[model samples]
Target: MYALENEGGIKKVKKLDQFLQDNLNDLRDRGLYNEIDPVEGPNGPVIKISGKELINLSSNNYLGLATNDHLKEIAKHAIDQYGVGAGAVRTINGTMDLHVKLEEKLAEFKGTEAAIAYQSGFNCNMAAISGVMDKNDAILSDELNHASIIDGIRLSKAKVIRYNHSDMDDLRAKAKEAAESGLYNKVMVITDGVFSMDGDLAELPEIVEIAKEFNLITYVDDAHGSGVMGKGAGTVKHFGLSKEIDFQIGTLSKAIGVVGGYVAGSKDLIDWLKVRSRPFLFSTALPPGDTAAITAAVQMIMDSTELHDQLWENGRYLKEGLLKLGFDIGKSETPITPCIIGEEKLTQQFSKRLREEGVYAKSIVFPTVPQGTGRVRNMPMATHTKEMLDQALAVYEKVGKELSIIN
Candidate 1:
């Protein structure tokens, strides 16, 4: 069936195909369309893309564990013992010993009663939030919460009320409204512990206080916060308010340098997810190697704060250097820095110019953010060397002046 652009329009259109062309053309015309390139080498601060080595700030390898020899060795050893995939979903005979161990380590690291792993951080949101609250519940989401959350909440059939980003007052107001609406059996306040794009942290302390005052269920997606904040535990631990939050969602991908996500909460919560979370019940379990590698990474994070310290040092160094060069680095408290460019086209051009000049920071624009708040996000990994950062800063300075983004 042909899809009509508008009910009043006489023209019928190939909805999927026409939709893609229209969107792509619009993006390209605005200089916001990007073509993905494969990484040829390790995901270090420098990566080989299209046979050219570039100073890479585009990856999410926060602690540099993605390419660390220690994690590699552990994963290899696990593979030798367990032989790749678990071959089925967790419930249907894919729950390996390694899976249980990983969950145990994750629970210990997060200081939660129990933990349940999923295929990805995205799926964790899908699984956990949907498993807990359904059509009868209300979700008070932060305006800038990750897309996974928006989708997961949508899937749950819950009434989603969005509050202004990190505005505690707005959150409190929304909570009061949702609570008093008396239209739902449960009320949840959800936010990203560290907003990935802005690099700003959630007001967890205030959120916890609000949750306590309103008797709301609290959920913090710590995808960016897990290995970066709170001595490598998360934002909840960073604020010393772990016990106040009900559901803590984290990724094994970014800082843990592996692939997977988890929800840490009361034992009952995890139990509910196991039975009801579709992803966990239908998707294949994490391979032994990934599970073991994650376990090792978590242990390393808990055993010492060295990686976390290094990451912050690198972040501060880059932030200070960029700021000194007269660039608007935005208000970022974490290592995820964004060089805000007020216009979408300029931001995309700036990113392209940087890539040409040997830095690989990606540009975010338009719908990803607001209409005018486009930026190039720079993620500094713990393993970035002084020389690497210095080189990148020099390139940035040169490009900034050429593009008139700085003096």
Candidate 2:
């Protein structure tokens, strides 16, 4: 506990500012402090940061729909009809017709019996995980699961058994131990359908098989997989195991090009979340424009795979270009490319050099990934033209040679 002397003779805990300054200084000294760069305009294939235009590669806008003309129009129309905000929390007066419709479309899109939406993807994890699992339960979570999932499990107060990343054997061993331990009331296995940092797909088929063997509850957060896999449905649909998984989690902000998160699952599960999830019950509903745009985005994805295909094409082009330049592009099953640079400060320097040379891929370091595996993560969007990718590649080559990261 930190305390400071008050103006009078009283002792007070007024060292918060000192604490923050010390921690911030430590991060800066260690090269772990992240500096936020504000984009000057719309976040698209090309972005203006500090008045300089660069090929944007740090965004999660996989489909490039965030700045789509049609979606923008729909969002404007929604604002006209319903104003900017959802007046109250869902349990109060906030459950608008658009909310109902969006949930319906989400259920249809995810191939689930029902769905519930939350304010954000992070909140969905916080709400859903704690809503279902309690202290008596045990969760066998993938070691590389998203930070949101980790925090959600912590909130649940469940016994968290971390399985090695994408290791089915480890998962099975842990699942069996937890399920037959006779201490837990229930056992659950949760994983990200697509690990965001490394861009690897989870082995859902094996996980589903193991879950069935032990009657484990299965949860897949497909925030990155949805709209990019399974003809734009999700990873669950990709593996043809929609009916087998217990929770199908996704976000509207990423490929969907809007804002919000949802859990699509059995009707009972959704119903339970609606009432039990703290965020859904306590926070205001998603605003009207975002909800409408999200619905439109899902419809566009279901209507065609044009954007999805283009995204993959750009991803492959960028990946090939980086690999050809002798950069250590990791084995990414998706478009999320990581140009591996070994040290944290050097990785940050590499990213800084890339930006200076007109690319905007961000460096991801320790705490986001393990130490010594720092890299610049590139997210190629659907709208990135061939010329844009070539330019980015040229910049990468120059920076790589300058840093002696490649031959």
Candidate 3:
């Protein structure tokens, strides 16, 4: 026990105190300490942070619809009609018409027979995997799969065999072994549609081919690809394999610029999830406003590819700019540009200087990524004006040169 003078002889357990203090101190010393910046007002390409206006490259607001006027009006109208809360879990009076509409819209947007919604993209993965998998099942997962998928696989009590990231040969060999082993009743192959860290796409066509060859159930968590690919349908549609893939998970929070997640697939699969998915059965449904807002946003994406095209154009522009400046922007096939700075402390310092220079991109290091592969992941949006990007590039060049990240 340790006594604090200010506590007037109250004794605190030293062991518990030491554990938290030691971990926190170690995190700070290792440049792994994450200081959360509070953004004032709505999230857009540019945002106000601590009263300073910065070009925001950190948010997941891809299509700039987080502050869209149409979505705002729709959300307001839905709140006016349905109030704020969902009142209870989806199985208990929480399944409102708005939820039904959102699911239907998601199914249509994803070109699937049916769809199911959850509280978040993470919850969607947790629910979908465990709902269909169990102790006797086996999952052949990608090494670079999202954290949510990893957790869900772990929860299902399934044997997880991780294949190399986007390595089709490794996938084929593992799928063959898992299929022939006779050790499990079912086998599934799961991958992220887009790898968030490197901004690379999953080899979905090859993955689908392997799934069919091995008679494996295919699951893709398209959290980063929903509104950014195939005119906003998803990676499945992007590859024209909508009917081939089994479980297609997505988030309304990223490209859709809203909050929530979903799984779109065959009617039987979705129906089964509706009944067995813990989040859908036990957690409260999405707020009425979010449900309606997501539906409207999906419909807008379906109506045209205007926003999608803009997003790509900006992505290309930013990538080209960063490359020309000689920053080690990694091989990203999407808008997620990672300026790889190999040292942990310099990476954090670079992000800090960028913030001071009126850019708000955050530094990513450690367990989120690897130790030496530290980088600043920039997410440019559809709403970024050319002038804004030019300013950002100038700031980037200045800081990049100062840190010797570029000559």
Candidate with maximal lDDT: 2
- The TM-scores of all predictions, comma-separated, are 0.95, 0.97, 0.97
Off by over 4 Å in 1: 1-16
lDDT of 3 by residue, 137-232 (tens): 999999988889999999999999999989999999999999999999999999999899999999999998898898999999999999998878
Give per-residue CA lDDT, model 1, range 1-407, as digits (tens).
45656677677777797889888898899877877888997888799888888988988998899998998999999999999989999998999999999999999999999999999999999998888899999999999999999999999999989999999889898899888888989999999999999899999989998998888999999999998999899988999987888999999999999998999999998898999999999999999999999999999999999989999999999999999999888889899999999898899889988989899999998778888999999999998899989999999999999988999
- Candidate 2 has a TM-score of 0.97
- Candidate rank order under TM-score: 3, 2, 1
Clashing pairs in 1: none
* Stretch of 10 with least lDDT, candidate 1: 1-10
Error of 3 at 272 (Å): 0.6
Q: What is the TM-score of candidate 1?
A: 0.95
lDDT of 2 by residue, 173-239 (tens): 8888888889999999999999999898999999999999999999999999999989899889999
Q: How well does model 3 score by local distance difference test?
A: 0.92
| Displacement of the residue 18 alpha carbon in candidate 1, Å | 3.6
